[model samples]
Target: MDIITSHPRIVKMKKNDITLYISTFPLETEDDFLEKLKETFDVEEACDGKNMAECFAIIYGGIVISKNSIFKRIELEGYFKESDKGIEFEINRFLENPYNCYTFDNGTICFIKNKEKDSRFVDNVGLRFIIK
Candidate 1:
């Protein structure tokens, strides 16, 4: 696994959805990360692996939210050939707009939220992204 300490916001929500705060630095080399993500998510390769090259930042977060009870489980058999990373699936219920979707090179889907310093949603969500 890559050194993900900087982006502590990446976490398991429930069991299917992943929500990521994209303002942080991007994850490891976009290519490698996407390859791992595609294998992790089990999404069929839509085109040649070349399509993955256009991804932006690497996102890490939970996919499952409270509204849905079903969990999106990701099989890690071929993705990580070594150590077994504890993977958790979660459902995402906070999506109010499709514009919030952020996709990495490998097809990892992350929901992003952009807010001001004094936004009430931030205060209520109690979300902290700092590594400390």
Candidate 2:
């Protein structure tokens, strides 16, 4: 899939010194796969504390696709302890879905379909996000 570097209204969030990137899944600009994301994730902008949170509906082609939310924060000693647990819990809860899965590489989040055999339709998907 192609990487989208920037967009007009993407949202960025920072917690415990770790940055979170969030953005809308463009339905028309890319290909049909993104359209699927738009249909499933219903990504939109919103606010969470001083940070920005993207509200999304997880859907797959007219079907309500199951999903989970993931948040990652820097594991600082006292100042960020609670925040780290909350973020990790959220990520774990989202990953528990049978049809969806996610992984964090360093701090980058990757959401994927949990299927044994991969198809082109699934392989063609891309994730959208913004960094502060």
Candidate 3:
């Protein structure tokens, strides 16, 4: 995977003491992207708040974990996999799914995925933010 260092968010976030990074993993096809996405969700199924600080949000294919913030734990109650529609179906519609906001407090984790993964961006995986 190639590193996308020139993304605007990366530049802007840097000044704010937040780090952003994206991987250039080719998104060959939407199907492939969904599969990988499902895997990612599964791997991060729960944010038990083992060692959180303030609050965290999963935005646009990146994770923004903020320390000394105002959150304690994020409830994973309505995550895609928890939908009644089924994980596969929900995963397919994730791009436009409305239950996108997942917040946790005291040092939780968030995952970001963005439009950059579209063919317009050469189907490269979206930016993945990991702020300390």
Candidate 4:
């Protein structure tokens, strides 16, 4: 299936709904991915994919947030709830994991979970590229 059409946001969006610009695409490499990210977000700065953590920094809600390889999941009493500009969804499936991309502090980029069930990063290209 086409990545954009099969994307959760695309599949779930309604005609008159307010939503955030969340989408996923095939990831190629840190450099290439950063290049693509620049197209949407005003990326202030990024770390060298080899040090501290393979992280990307962007301004969201007027705050700079960075995502790195460190991942921790909290148990939920029910399906995980996430909302964006009134758009919401219950997370219960592998595909419903919401965020898909993860980068290690060592410069490695991969899925945060269910790597097998998800797509693959082939020849420097990753399986998922997420924008939130």
Candidate 5:
């Protein structure tokens, strides 16, 4: 995040852009999940622990977590998945669902979609915010 000024939260974005997709593989407890999201992710989900953890979210995407330090952890604790390509494929598939909206911080806040398996730029470029 490139900082232009402090007050309004304006920052330069990236070129290729990166989207971090997060998820809990077989959650321990719904109660814990809700509290964790509320505390850590600042996200909330209705509870009851009635279904598998997958039901809580789809693709569980987020941002800025694989910055070398994070990827260093092992399976017992590390967040980054072992297979990135696999995860990318899965994310591409996940984005295909109509309910999902794929976006990027590529120099501008852009709402995008998967045009093909590996399409980078969208035709319309969708909605964007250019920092003047």
Candidate 6:
């Protein structure tokens, strides 16, 4: 799925017709977001991954308004909502439970959620990556 289109915004999920880019904090990709984030990783390595980071960034209003976005920091691995767009159904961050997404300010998206909190990070993205 070489999504060379303007934005990967599908507007509806094939499975449930779930509306896209209607998140609380704006998940829509902006026009220049690709260029802004292009600096963070190797072009091929960065854009090419299961995390679908680039796809999500592109479709979900690609503009990274803040340098503090989770994408700028870690290698988040997960399955994409739309295999073509690269949005690996991670989390809205606002609607999802803190246990499913990364809750630490130090900058880290947790892949594993442990109940034992040693005054460290918190898992808000849940136990699994939502593979479907």
- The model with the greatest TM-score is 2
* lDDT by residue for model 2 (1-132), tens: 433322222223333433334332333344443444444543331111222222221111111121234433221111100111122314335435413222333332333333233211221122444324
TM-scores vs. true structure, each candidate: 0.18, 0.19, 0.17, 0.18, 0.18, 0.17
Which has the better lDDT: candidate 1, or candidate 2? Answer: 2
lDDT of each: 0.26, 0.28, 0.26, 0.26, 0.27, 0.28
lDDT (10s digit) by residue, model 4, range 1-132: 222211111111212221112223332244543554455443333323422212211111111112233322222111112222232322233235534332222222223323344343221111234445
Between candidates 1 and 3, name the one with more favorable TM-score: 1
Q: Kindly list the per-residue Cα lDDT of model 6 for residues 18-111, writing each as its tens digit.
A: 1222111222234443433444434344355423433443434321212222442122222212111222333355234323332222233322
Clashing pairs in 4: 27-126, 53-105
Of 2 and 6, which scores higher on TM-score? Answer: 2
Tens digit of per-residue lDDT, candidate 3, span 43-127: 2332234222211222122223232343222222121211112222122243354334222221211223334222111112232
Better of 4 and 6 by TM-score: 4
Scored against the true structure, residue 25 in model 6 reaches a CA lDDT of: 23
Local accuracy of candidate 5 as per-residue lDDT tens digits, 15-89: 243233233333223245444443444333433352322222221312222232232111111222121222222
Per-residue lDDT of model 1, residues 5-114, tens digit only = 22112222222233322222122333443454445543334223521211111132222222233223221111111112222222232233322323322333333254
Identify the runs in model 1 with alpha carbons over 4 angstroms from their true place. Answer: 1-9, 15-24, 30-43, 46-132
lDDT of 4 at 132: 50
lDDT of 3: 0.26
Model 5 TM-score relative to the real fold: 0.18
